[model samples]
Target: MMAGLEERLDKMELAIRKQTFRENSGRANEVNFWVFDYDPKKELEVRERIEYMKKKNEKGTEGFQLIVFDLYDMIMEYLEEKDFVNSYGRFEKRRGFDYIIRAVSTSMKMNEDDSILIRKIVEQTPENAVVFLTGVGKCYPLLRSHKILNNLHQSVLKASVVLFFPGTYTEQELILFNEIKDDNYYRAFKLVK
Candidate 1:
């Protein structure tokens, strides 16, 4: 049992290293990452998602890291990514970003635990990188009401967010949360389909 666990751990480390090496290989000192769909079946789903990205991006001839994390693992992964970028001479100007598309599926008001962790990560990232959050239903109200989020610059939002409100949103809601959708820094709601 211990040996099996050890092998799995080694595999995980290798996967992360492979991603890091690929993304930084030819991007002119830039870091490109994709935070894809998350699922509870982490090991299998994540690996499959990475493989899918690998195939999809094959024509680009450039390396990029594609990450997927379960809600339980999101916080730690964010911190790990934080440290990883900092170590590579990008302590503040980190180039990586994350996506949270499970917000609606996981909680009616957004997961406070995840929200706090994401807030910390965004607070720590540099001003240039973008973070995106997306999911079905309106997470805008909750996000806007959070006192900790108001002060966070759009440039440093824990992640560039694309709240999946699903239905047409009111102008008032847009006005209240438009900064969250500022496209000057990064693209929001990049249509995958």
Candidate 2:
């Protein structure tokens, strides 16, 4: 576990619990998006802590609702359900990396209207709930972090979106796995230090 993991989690919880956070007060017109950046090596620990947080704060009642969006799982299930797995691999080898990336991005509906993942995020989230977005590392080369943020900032405006980013968020750009530059997404604030 990382040092002060408990404190960071507590800060996240308290931020999500506060009315101002949900309402986006004093944000200077920024959406209610936050980045909970952590070391990529501690992914399992972060996931465990997230589960603990969810257990402590149940969704839909009593406390604020918490909806987690695991991008890797979402894409896997989607690929399986659509029977695109076989063809997807074939496309990668035949069409080249860039072409395959575009195909997968188009199929995933990234930053587009009627995107299944975006729709799920909007539909599943109730007002004032917390949306935890994980699996950035796993969804690499397909679903970029900035693209999702761009998509959500316009649609899912009510709920507080907390992205469990497995990298560094410098309030300027996202560095996935500390090597890949995920482009600039300055809309979201850093959830904890």
Candidate 3:
């Protein structure tokens, strides 16, 4: 399974490097977006493979640049900068999961914050870049691919974006980690395995 997955990743990298979107394409309308689904149990292994591939691609003269944006790290940084850690820590200590969920939902506008951060990151990326968006499992039930991609402007992001999703994609629906089944999103294409 790992070998097969690696092969798929290689193919995905090639497709991303080769794909080009027209200027008139609307947000989330271009086929430049891809999802790499994998077994949730092998998250660590999958991440390691992706990292290895990223390094390998960087060393080669592929013409396209690889940029990784980890959502977990972004959320942590946002919480730290907003000084909400102490409060969340207290909530976690006292109330546990429920309080933490409520606090996160109330404090962080997940889509808005992620959109801003992603836009900033995308804006800084050079031409012929492939942005790898990861850490979807970490932000389950909060940060969703459809929401983020729907919010992003096609004009600002000239390069392809691949989301490393630890989930299942059946038909057009997305089931994150095999738990949260999302609506059918028509914009992005699934990376063939």
In order, the Cα lDDT scores of the candidates are: 0.33, 0.81, 0.70
Report the number of the highest-TM-score candidate.
2
Ten contiguous residues minimizing lDDT sum, candidate 2: 56-65
Q: Provide the RMSD of all predictions against the true structure, rounded to 1 decimal.
A: 16.7, 2.5, 3.6
Query: Using lDDT as the measure, what is the rank order of every candidate, best first?
Result: 2, 3, 1
Kindly report which residue stretches of model 2 are placed more than 4 angstroms away from their true locations once superposed: 1-3, 59-62
Between prediction 1 and prediction 2, the one with superior lDDT is 2
Query: Residue-wise lDDT of candidate 1 within 57-122, one digit each (tens)?
Result: 446443332222222344335446656423433523344322232332233223343355455555
Give the higher-TM-score candidate: 1 or 2.
Answer: 2
Query: What stretches of model 1 exceed 4 Å from their correct place?
Result: 1-115, 120-128, 136-161, 174-193
> What tens-digit string does per-residue lDDT give for candidate 3 at 1-193?
2346767766766665554532224354653666788778879987887798689778857667788888777777888988988988887888997777766655665446345456566677677777788888987654676666665534367766677888786538888888888884646667666
Whichever of 1 and 3 has more TM-score, that candidate is 3
Provide TM-scores for the models: 0.25, 0.89, 0.79
lDDT of 2 by residue, 72-181 (tens): 89989988998998987888788887987787788877768658788888888777677899998898878888888888876745787888888888999999888888
Q: How far is candidate 3 from the true structure (C-alpha RMSD, Å)?
A: 3.6
